[model samples]
Target: MADHLPPVAREPAAESGTADEPGVPRPATGDSGLRRTGARGASGPRQAYAAIDLGTNNCRLLIARPAGDSFVVIDAFSRVVRLGEGLAQSGRLSDAAMDRALAALQICADKLRRRNVHLARSVATEACRRASNGAEFIERVRRETGIALNVISAQEEARLAVLGCHILLEQGEGPAVIFDIGGGSTELVLIESGPAVPRILDWQSVPWGVVSLSETCGPEGADATQRAARYQRMRSLVDEAFAPFAERIAPARADPPTAESLRLLGTSGTVTTLASLHLDLPSYDRSAVDGVIVPATAMRAIASRLSGLSLAERREVPCIGRERADLVVAGCAILESILDIWPADRLGVADRGIREGILRSLMATGLRRDGAGALRTGQDAV
Candidate 1:
């Protein structure tokens, strides 16, 4: 873990921003950094907690102060770096990809420092897990950015994703499933949870995310026929990967899920992006999408429509620009597969996940003490 950050480096928005606006990923501001109105929990001064998540598709950071049962976010940053761009074939983190990720990490480090973060945890996901040079890259990050990153296991990844989003699960009596369709992998967590919070009953991580699936199928330049065929093929692959999990949950599936008995929650670019489309927003709005529930049929329609579009046509979609156009269909494939297995009426979207999980862990355990600092930022008089 120490080797992952050699001490170094590290976006956006048109949104008013907060938990509701995790969507609009801004480009790294570079020298401009980010100007934010500092915030903190009313707990006098336990200082602030920070979390950084470096995924194959994006790098994000969140700083907050524990507020009663949860934390109030003071600042946040996210950028789509596509860190695992070519790893599917190369089995390595490409030079260009590493450069992009390193730059993002640097920005996160600065935010952490400037915020006077009392406790911070950073983690890297599937891309790093699969890269042959992943360890080396993490070490370099630590040295260059002065931030340490933990490359977590699939199980831990599933757990954290659940920890981050389960609070948003719909109130119900039966079991629920929360999944994250990421860049290089997808995690599905099945839990027999109710109002208090869903507990992880079982979970699965498939090595197919929007980035990896698109890479595997190469749908960018294909004609409509080819793109549709490729999208189905991607779905087929995800279905196969998900088979075991589906089988394992057969007992739970005995009665099937209804809107009231079972719920589906999703945390990832795929779900959030799809939610934005479902609402037909002029631009991505986290508040509009986050914790919002959409009909499963509506989500599938968006996915199918997107699959039939040309790469150029996709770039014209509101929330999806050139940055996400190519990867959206693959995400659709993963999401559709999830909907199929679970057969739920509605799908819930959560913009918060790993970062929130990390913050909860730190604050809950006193792993990082509180009352040591007063302000959310370094400014003395906040």
Candidate 2:
């Protein structure tokens, strides 16, 4: 959501080039490593770590320095590269999509170079994981941008997402369902959160993200009557995908929490967009939207109204620009399906996720060496 960041997935480091899972190994680092800012007249090296998430729909980077207990942002960048634009049917990434993604990675490479990031990790999600030439594209990125992008599994993606954004879960003992509606796939994690990072008791990765769904389902209908039929079809598609997951978790938590204890948290473009519209923001404001809780009924109303509108009409809405108008409705469809499965009264919105998880994982070691004991708590200026 623009330059504004979520109170990031307040989790830890991740790894790539080493494991199929997201781990905390150096991502964009050269042999030189990060500069210990003694050269800058600071007591310790102004070491920083970078995490890039090359999702099907967006390319996001987060650079930060360790704070006392957590980390603080230094510099960040994100772009709508639409890497999975047509992968649903083609089973291969288009040249245009790869080019857009490569261009964005180059920008990230430049930032990591300028910041002298010590340890970093970059990951590719559903788009790359699904593409036939995904490996070739990763090699090209390495040669051109010098950023090794690891195409992680849906399970790893789900784990990292939860690792990054679980902090936003409402404080209740009852199991909370945290979902990340991504571009090509949606990750739903059932968590038993404790004092520390949330535990993933079970998780599911449904292959119905905005990009893939729109490509398959087509338009949101031209009029209200058609729109209703289209919406039901979309809902049914998602519902079927979710049915297996529902059965698996159904009996696990046989004694479900009451309305007061259950929490539904969503971290994705769809949820944020709906929250922004519900708040009547002329434009997206991460500060106002991140970690904000909105009533499920309000979000349902917003999605219904959006479902009834045509593509051109959706483009008229403030944040639903040309790039997102078509896909946002698909996202709404996914959100509505989730709401039906987990009837939480209020939904918590998270702006942070994958990147934040990487930072937290890497910082587990970086924090010990950050030397900026004073700078540990805040590095927003860096």
Candidate 3:
């Protein structure tokens, strides 16, 4: 999954005097009356909203307060729990995977409480949707972590993703494609720009992501020749899965895509990691990677180079490290397939995704006070 920081505003310091966790917020000091006011200039203390996105590979959280038309991130958390590690083979979430996810969620629950978040939404994607024991896992998370995990469908996932990162898309004519390459599935959305948000023309979600594809195609090869063959096989699998979506959009593209004719934005670890490699950054940097457009040829070259390396060599590369080395190859295959169909000259990379989308949804429909003096959220505001 991509990092959850919103591109509009920087994170502010916590109210407490002491330093807080890197992105996670610390508990506020003094009485609640001393807090800052809401963006609407209301006399009451500002309401902190939180969003948690639990994906097949990572668990991430974002906390923010309304700021004018956008929101400023106050705290955040992200962890790679590989929640879908063995689900493809067993058709269920492994005990270890669930344990890892639970641990991360516990930390998220702690942060939400510390920040005194007014309203929040926690969502689980493809992993939970596919596993036979997904609902059981949601119950376990709620019981153990006090966080209700909403298992959303693929279409909703795609919609939220487009809502989150569509702002980063370069200006262009015709329709634009925004895609999210996840751990268990890849979502491709075809949309036309609207007045406030992009109107979804069509979308498709395929069951091929980094973890699932890597596991389904077997381990990375030991030698260059074998690795090339494996890469080809992975590409073939993604291509076959995307065939229907590709054909559906063919009628819309009468002429070939040029820099201005086709616009493509990608929100996921795959595109962001590839963008980092393209910039030759010593380490991963969200500020540097987010919203930057890179040449399609350059991205494809980097993916090609990474695919040729052995697992050990990939592990040694900056940004990828041990956690991503095994799975990035699958990401590369999925990304290459996207490029083949869209054929955009430049690719827009977004460090933001579903969590940001959730925040936008929450903030757009301002919370209201209920008869009992507690806050109540609006319905389907996004």
Candidate 4:
């Protein structure tokens, strides 16, 4: 489940010649009067920051050190824990799922210790948000693995996703859409871009992601027609959930957005996996897939093809394997439904999301300027 990539930090393409807006200061790193204190003392090496995103399906960790404005990833780990495996029907995390997640957390704990992580924030999304025993589980994780998992709200999930991946957004005039299709839910954020950091206009979260959608729709069909029907059902469910958000944003655009006007970016395993397939790569490669743009039609075609594929066929497909075969169709449906609403000619794919967002926030001085030119703290600066 760990999609390994070489350690590297590539700056995203700059915005298309836009003046910096007042009060929208970009995240400043070490110069922000923040000091790094290691286990030895303040005179030791730079502080190592870590962020853990325990999603419904994946347990991911990122360890990095601040470098100028951006950060270089020192270590990273991801594993498909499926913490919400049966939560949809049970309304709680199953014992097996908890055990699976705990095992992954143990690995993360080992990494944090070995890396000498100074400041680390671990947040759990959708599954824990809806589970009845989520708090109990968080406490259990702390006791067992020495890792505290913060169950973040859906709104915060969307905000962090936008903060993490907005840099990969294509330069455009109107508002842009940034989305994260997680394991148990999907978050879409609409932002107005001008400054180095885009200002969020509105956002929405729908409790329909690969795990929930696939479980709700039942397993993949036994045949092509059945699979196609299941895929359509998944799309319909997602469309219904997204309808309200779509209507709310419709008035913001008087007419349909042209190719140059609309900017759409997606950060999730779904998009990254599909991008890898779109490139026909021999295996998953973050360097090639990250920040790459693919035509919307091409993406749609790939989704359609994937939807038609049987589970076994999908498993045989390279870059998918057995790990993602069962859930990828639901991902394709969610992606297609998103394309239907936003309809950007080209889709920007980002391999980074919540973990990166958390790292940036942790490295920043936790201070920002408000619209009225007053200094503010802790209100989504990063």
Best by TM-score: 3
Q: lDDT tens string, model 4, 1-382?
A: 1122222435433221111110022333322212122243221136677788899999988877776778777777788889999888989999999999999889888887887766677788999989999989988997898776778878778877887877788766878889999999999888888677788888899999899999999877788888888988999999999999998887554444475567789998889888888899888877788878888888899899989988879899888888789998999999998887888778888888988888888766322211234222222111
Give residue 354's error in model 4 in angstroms: 0.2
- Model 2 C-alpha lDDT per residue in residues 1-382, reported as the tens digit of each score: 2122244533333221111111111233232112222123233335777888999999998888776667777877878889998898889999999999999889888887787776777888898888999999988997898777767778778878887877777777667899999999999988887778777778899999999988888666667888778777888999999998888877544556555556888999899888888888888876677778888889998998998888889899986778788888889899998887777778998888988887787677555544544323212211
Between candidates 3 and 4, the lDDT winner: 3
Ranking by lDDT: 3, 4, 2, 1
Candidate 1 C-alpha lDDT tens digits along 1-382: 0011111100122222233234501212222111112344433355676788899999998888766677677878898888999899999999999999999888887877677776666788999999999999988997898767778878878887887887777766667788998999999988876445456788899999988998988645457777777887998999999999999987786555344466788999888888888888899876567678788889999999998999889899999988888899899999999988888878888878888877777666443433554423222210
Candidate 4's displacement at residue 158, Å, is: 0.7
| Predicted candidate 3 versus true structure: per-residue lDDT over 177-264, tens digit per residue | 9999999999999998887788899889999999999999888777999999999999999999999999999866545445448888
The reply for model 1, stretches above 4 Å from the true place, is 1-46, 194-197, 256-260, 367-382
The local distance difference test score of each candidate is 0.77, 0.77, 0.81, 0.78
Which residue segments of model 4 deviate by more than 4 Å? 1-45, 253-256, 366-382
Q: What's the CA error at residue 191 for candidate 3, in Å?
A: 0.8
What does each candidate score in C-alpha RMSD?
9.6, 7.6, 7.3, 8.4
Q: TM-scores for all candidates? A: 0.85, 0.85, 0.87, 0.86
